[model samples]
Target: MAKDNRIQMLPAEWRASTTLSGVYALRMLGMFLVLPVLALYAAGLPGAADNKALVGLAMGMYGLTQALMQLPLGMASDRFGRKKVIYFGLIVFAAGSFMAAAADTLEMLVAARAVQGAGAVSAAVTALLADLTRDGVRTRAMSMVGLSIGLTFSVSLVLAPILTELVGVPGLFALTGVLTVISIGVVAWATPNPQISKLHEDAEAQPARMGEVLRDSRLLGYDFGIFALHASQMALFTALPFALVDLGWDKVQHWKVYLPATVIGLIAMVPLVIVGETRNKLKQVFLLGIACVAAAQIVLFAGLGSLWSIGLCLAVYFIGFNVLEASLPSMVSKTAPSDLKGTAMGVYNTMQSVGLFSGGAVGGLLFQHYGFSGVFGFCTALLLLWLLVAACAPAPQPVKNLGFAVPPAWQGRQEPLRQRLSAVAGIEAVRFSSDGQTVYIKALQEGFDQTAAEQIISGAN
Candidate 1:
């Protein structure tokens, strides 16, 4: 069969990717559905009065545990298998949801949320996708996962009020539990198993690379970028629904505000993202996004007196939020070494989880003591720091991720094969799995000679 150079996914790959991606979407949807209304619900719960700190903790408790356990879960998947770990996590997530549903006190709420966080399995999911995919199509597969999370966030925001109105917060929690439980069925029945497990350089995190991943300034830039972005988001949301209600928007009708803002924000994101990827202006786009997020927070703080003002600010905020959210992972993948890709992402996710925790924790603390200005100001400072991080970061190489099948004949002798493939001009990196079923490479320049590279891989050159 003649080799086709254009990027495409196998049918099985697409089925697995989309199904796993659905799992991500479902998880994110469960997490975010409460964001738009949690504050209001907490204030009404028993023992919530004057317990602002615990309430804050309740809001971000999931992040605290998620951050702490993310790597361990990834490593566990490496040992016990990805599906098993994911199933365990999902079960834990469902249990937490039910606990949250049963809680009537703020302290109980926080504990349930913490339990919810303990089910952190994001790295495992990514690792599984890596296990299932060839490097060439990994980015596309990852994007599907990323898009699911992003889209779910927007939909969750819009649905929060509706869900809250129909079922109340506890009922919503119950619904999430049901959703997560359903996903386990989807996983067992619909997801395909990988033929063999291998250490994918581009996907799974390695313990040994911890130092190198941490030390890289470029990776750190992406790290701080995600951290600040999510932190500001969590902080803004801690107060945003309350801010909306203060301006005469009904608590149950908040989705009216979120729908337009989320949609418009997403629409506004397209052009800049295109320019960043197509024009190779990623750094510029990244910095601009941080600035936009800060500016939106500032606007929200200043213009809280009007519903329209808050709506406008949300649109601005989501535009920046969506762009930063979409681009940061891409930057991480591009900046990380192939072997440390998983490790780099693990650290990145930890920062993100920390940001999630801090946003709620710190935002609530400040709001209790200093009012709304303090929370937004704190978030703004974080965004500014991310801006500086982006400014000083190393320029990322403009290369695309590619994967090729290593013919079975060469199987176990991939070491010598990598040695030969690495010698080819324009091939910046070459790596193979332990089983030698896949060959992953990064091209050095634009319009890389894929045909020439394949000839070398086929041992036909």
Candidate 2:
């Protein structure tokens, strides 16, 4: 049979990806939904008035635990199986939700939130995503997951008021618990098992060299970008709720503002993103995003008390936030060595966890003492620092994606095959092993011919 080289969408895999992505997004949405209203809710809880610090701890400790446990859990998934790990995580998350729901005081809620953080399984979900997709379309598949999360953030903000209005804070936690349970059903019944791609890292692959990954400045740049992006997000949310309240909006109606800001931000972001990707100006785009974030912080610091002014600042902030959110992974993928993609992502996620924790923790303390201006000031300083780091960082070479198939007879002659594959036009990196060989050709994505290379490899064999 002739090999097809066309870049076609995966119709068959869409349903599973969509379902699983929704499940992942829903989990994240549960956490984010409370962001815009948590401050008000916390102020009302018994003992919350005495120690708002505990509330901050409760809010941010989840990220700390999440960062600590993510790698181990992901490794465990490799050993114990993805579904099993994910199921366990979901159960733990549900338990945390229930604990928070049943809490009589702020202290209990904090403990429950920390327990919820203990269930961090982002790496496992990502590993499963890679497991379920073919090499050629894996990035696009992953993008669907990214898109789901983005959509969830936007939708959760819009829905938070409505959900909170109907069920209140405790009910929101309960609803999240229920949603997680439903996702387990979706996982068991709907997701397909792709014949695992031996070409990519498997459950049992030896952990890649951390030293090498850490030393790669380019990868570190991408990691820093992720950290900064998430940190900014968490920090902004810490004060945004209170800021809205001071602007005369009630907690229940805050989503009215969120809905429009998010929508406008989403709309504004697409064009800038397209221009960056299409025009090969990703570095320029990234720096610009940092600048925008810094500017937004200034705007927020100056004008948060007025509803219209706050809206305007948010419009600016989300424009930067959304673009950077979409681009960071792509930057990571392009910068990371193909074999170490999993390891790089693991480290990147760890950085994100650190950011999430620090952002909320620091933002909370800043808010407690210095008011909203201090919170935005902190974000501004962080962004400026990040901008400097990114500005000095080296830009990545655009990698091309092309591959060759190994014929049956020469499966054992992998090293020589890698040598030959490397000689192919536009091929830049090659990884070949006895089990299933993969050739990562670096050329323009659209310019490479997958079929012709397959024929060449078959003929050579």
Candidate 3:
């Protein structure tokens, strides 16, 4: 095939990916909008006085429920329908947001947050996306989803402080509810319906593969890394707002610190990621990111009293945070068995939610007992342990997923097709759909003989 003849997304595929990305981003924006202001706002609620633990619970409660509901809701999408489950999840999320808006106490807020989290729709949305797009274009579609989440986080960091100042926490929660409701309409009208929705091993978790994914030590390491990353994030935010306030920055002005730190950190991350990918020094780059995060914690622990010093620390933290956040998933994909990728991601996402809850609960408890020292000390220690785990783990080789259209004659001849593809140089693993219409290959990033594979796929060999 000529270079320009490569498969590209059709108009329908483009519409599906973009609209679904929008739907996913809207839901995530609702969740992220509260991260910066939740702790400080919750502190003023009834039953929260001097009870930072309760405040933390209020802040992190959504993660616990989200973790518990993700798999079940995903499976429910299989049994029911994709759009139906998504609509249901959105309604539940909206209800919780409204409930949270009316909460008068920390306890009420925690319960409301849990309700908010029960609407886990990520897996279903992903599965639907896979259903709508051909395998060759799926990765591009998925990247859009990831990009939306990153953009949402950046927007939330800048907008949260200003929004909080204008309407207060209760009003923010109400606004989230409204946005979620609007997302339901997007799902109904804007999002395209899939012709067929079935279990897609590349996109949805499989029950039989659970043990295989869980037993992989390398995959487990990536899972732990994600857990640590998000836990540290939640813990840091649990105390950061108050720290800024004490440093003489008003709640509304906190964006000044976050906006610059996030922008600069993102700018700094580009070159490191480029070098890591282009030079094959991913492990080195990954470790450096870990060190940056740990160093930021140490800076905070040493008590940076000035706003500028704290801002610098935040910039350092975001640099590490963004790098790890971006690379960890890539590493997981490289490490996981091609067929079990979805299962591995399911487990990875679950651990992330668990980490969020743990960080908030523990950070609050630690801060209440030992002040900022305890919070930053815990974050520093966690990242150091993660760095050690990452250092000792096997380095990941660069690889990419390649999908081929299996000829109709190849149906019921899995063994032959598998053998032929497996014999191709640099093709590490081969998996086929149950119907045998598609073949997924894991191949080395370099030395993949695409022409040879294509010839075999086209029956011209």
Global lDDT scores for all candidate models: 0.83, 0.74, 0.88
Winner of 1 and 3 under TM-score? 3
**Tens-digit lDDT track for model 3 on 373-398?**
99999999999999999999978888
Using Cα atoms with residue i matched to residue i, what is each candidate's TM-score against the true structure? 0.94, 0.92, 0.97
What tens digits encode model 1's per-residue C-alpha lDDT throughout 393-417?
Answer: 7767776656677776678888888
Q: Write the per-residue lDDT of candidate 2 for residues 146-196, one digit (tens) a residue.
A: 898888888888898888999999988888888888888887788766466
Clash pairs detected, candidate 3: none
Q: Could you tell me the lDDT of residue 101 within candidate 3?
A: 97
| Candidate 1 to truth, TM | 0.94
Model 2: pairs clashing at backbone N, Cα or C within 3 Å: 400-443
* lDDT ranking from best candidate downward: 3, 1, 2
TM value for model 3: 0.97
Backbone clash pairs in model 3 (N, Cα, C under 3 Å; residues 3+ apart or in different chains), count: 0
Task: Indicate whether candidate 2 or candidate 3 has the larger lDDT.
Answer: 3
Off by over 4 Å in 3: 1-5
The lDDT leader among the candidates is: 3
